[model samples]
Target chain A: MQVFASLLAGLVFGLGLIVSGMANPAKVLGFLDLAGAWDPSLAFVMGGAIAVGAIAFFIARNRLVSLLGTPMQLPTSRAIDRRLVGGSLLFGIGWGIAGFCPGPGLVALGMGEVKALVFVVAMLAGMGLWVLFEARAGVSK
Target chain B: MTIAWSTFTPWSALAGGVLIGIAAGMFVLFNGRIAGISGILGGLLKPAKGDAAWRIAFIGGLLIAPLVYALMATLPMPQIDAGYGALILAGLLVGIGTSYGSGCTSGHGVCGLSRLSPRSLVATAMFMAAGFVTVFVIRHLINA
Candidate 1:
């Protein structure tokens, strides 16, 4: 059941990307080109995302447990530190330039786009680097 | 007639983002895990006590989603300007960054922020900053 839902959700996500024009790197790049002819589509995308999330969160907040048969693992930490600022900078810059963030990058793979492949490859490497650093620092898994 | 952007009838990327948030929330609700790619992928590296199957399943689901979509929609192909070497470097940088920060955008930005986590706020900011700087460097400074 978990597997089914996850896949179904992913499909819905991919479909959304396709419908929203996010599947096209050119569209994303165009939006980033403020100096040239800036496209406001990304903003619409952002707006659409925020709207859906707001309602969904409100509804889910009342639910005590998830359908997956386990308690939701909500983050308890609220620290505002260097690590947080640094990570957001990195993510945003990457998104602005590459025109694909982690989620869209993964979904872009289905498009068989070479650029998406490059991004995913790099994304995987980024994941590997974290593991290496964590091991060296003796961060308990 | 102006189209109302609020309702999102056809459901834009914003709709997708909302679904992603909802999915992340529900994922935690039932599975007790954050919908973070790095964490899930990281778990695959160590394969700790009874924690390999779900991680694999999660990634597998991500991979399969596109193939399924191809059947129903007209999927667009991505064109990569940079070479393979540049891409490898970028990937490594992101991996290192995620590790240092403790999680990816999805975990921190989507899930964490939804829960009003200050750490996520900072992380999201950093991720954005890094992306912006990298682009500025590549496009303006380095001329890549």
Candidate 2:
């Protein structure tokens, strides 16, 4: 049941990206192009999502287990360290360049975009490198 | 900056955002998880036992979303303007960065903000500022 619900959530999320024009890299770039003619639709998307999500999270704060009786696995880390800032900055640069974050990249790949395939493969390779780095550095992931 | 009034779409964006929120909300409420795309995908790399099914299933559903949308209406065209080299570079950056940060837009941007997490707030702010500066340099400074 949890797995099924996860799938449903993924579908809903993907549809949202499609409907919000977020699945389009060109559109995403338009939002990021702050110095240019800016399309502010992405802000609205963020606003709407946060409004609903905030309430859900507020309710989740008091709950110990989920409806399906699984323990909530919300993140517990609160450290505002170099990794967080540095990684996000790097991610942001990548986003600004291609306007394709992980979610949209996957959505495009699913749509059979060759460009997306290239991007996804490279992204995966990058991720693999991280795993290698962490293992060599004796860092617990 | 001039507002791209001709292209701005507030209503659809809001509607779509609400759907995204609901999906994320449902995952937390019933499934006890965050619907963070990068974290979900990245977790696959480690191949932990009993942890791979839901992630794969969720991604499967995401991949099938286009087919479902196509059944209802014509699929919207995604205009990706980045060249191959740029795309590859961007992909690598995104992959490494999100891993280091431990979240992406969905994780830190959407769900993190929703949780009112101070760490998430900082991450979001950093990423947004970086994005702004990067775009300014690429489109305005470098090309200008």
Candidate 3:
């Protein structure tokens, strides 16, 4: 049931990305191009998502288990440390360069974009490197 | 910044966002999970017992989304201006950063902000700010 829900969630999420103009790197770049002709559409996308998500989260917080009886697994970390800040900065720089974050990258890949193949493969490799480096650092997640 | 009125799609963007939120809502409400793309993909990197199945299932759905969309209507095309070098560089950064940062746009930007997580708030601001600065450098300073 959870697996089915996840698949459904992913499908809907990808459709939303398509519908929201988020799957379009040029449009995403338009939002980030603050010095250029900026598109304010992405802001509305985030706002609309948050408006509905906030309500769902509010209800989620009060629940002990999910509707499918799975354990709630929201993030537990609150530390605004170097990894969080630094990693995000790096990610942002990358996003600005290519306008492909993880989600859109995957969505584009699903659409069979060769460019997205490069991004996704490199992303996986980067994650692999993190695993290797973090393992050496005696950290595991 | 001048408003790009031509491409400003407030209505469609909002509707799509609602669909995304609904998807997220369903995940948390039914499955007790956050629909964060990077985190889910990251988990697949080091598959754990009894955990890898759903992650694969989720990603599989993502991988097949385009075909589904094509069946409904004419698929929209997204422009990719970056070359191979830039694409690879960006991908590596996104992979490492999302792993180290513990989330990406979907996880931290959408779900995290929705849950009012302070950590996500900071992460979101950091990425957005960095995105703004990077774009500034590339477009204005580098004169790309």
- Give a tens-digit lDDT track for model 2, residues B1-144: 899999999999999899889888998999889888889998999999999999998888788877788889899979988899999999999999999999899999999999999998998898888888888899999989
Which pairs of residues clash in candidate 2, taking residues 3 or more apart in a chain or in different chains?
A: none
Report how far off residue A119 is in candidate 1 (Å).
Answer: 3.4
Query: What CA RMSD would you report for each candidate?
Result: 4.5, 0.8, 0.9
- Our tally of clashes for model 3 stands at 0
Largest lDDT belongs to which candidate? 3
- The residue-by-residue lDDT of candidate 1 on B20-75, one tens digit each, is 65556556655656677666666676677866766666666666666776777655
Candidate 2 stretches with Cα past 4 Å from truth are none
**lDDT score, candidate 2, position B137:** 92
Of 1 and 3, the candidate ahead on TM-score is 3
Q: How far is candidate 3 from the true structure (C-alpha RMSD, Å)?
A: 0.9
| Predicted candidate 2 versus true structure: per-residue lDDT over A6-103, tens digit per residue | 99999988888888989999889899998899999999999999999999999998899999999998999999999999999999999899999898
Error of 2 at A63 (Å): 0.7
Residues A1-141, candidate 3, lDDT per residue (tens digit)? 889999999998888899999999999999999889999999988998999999999999989899999899887878999999999998898899999999889999999899999999999999999999998999885
Least accurate 10 contiguous residues by lDDT in model 1 chain B = B1-10
Model 1 misplaced stretches (Cα beyond 4 Å): A59-64, B1-11, B18-22, B29-32
Predicted candidate 2, C-alpha RMSD: 0.8
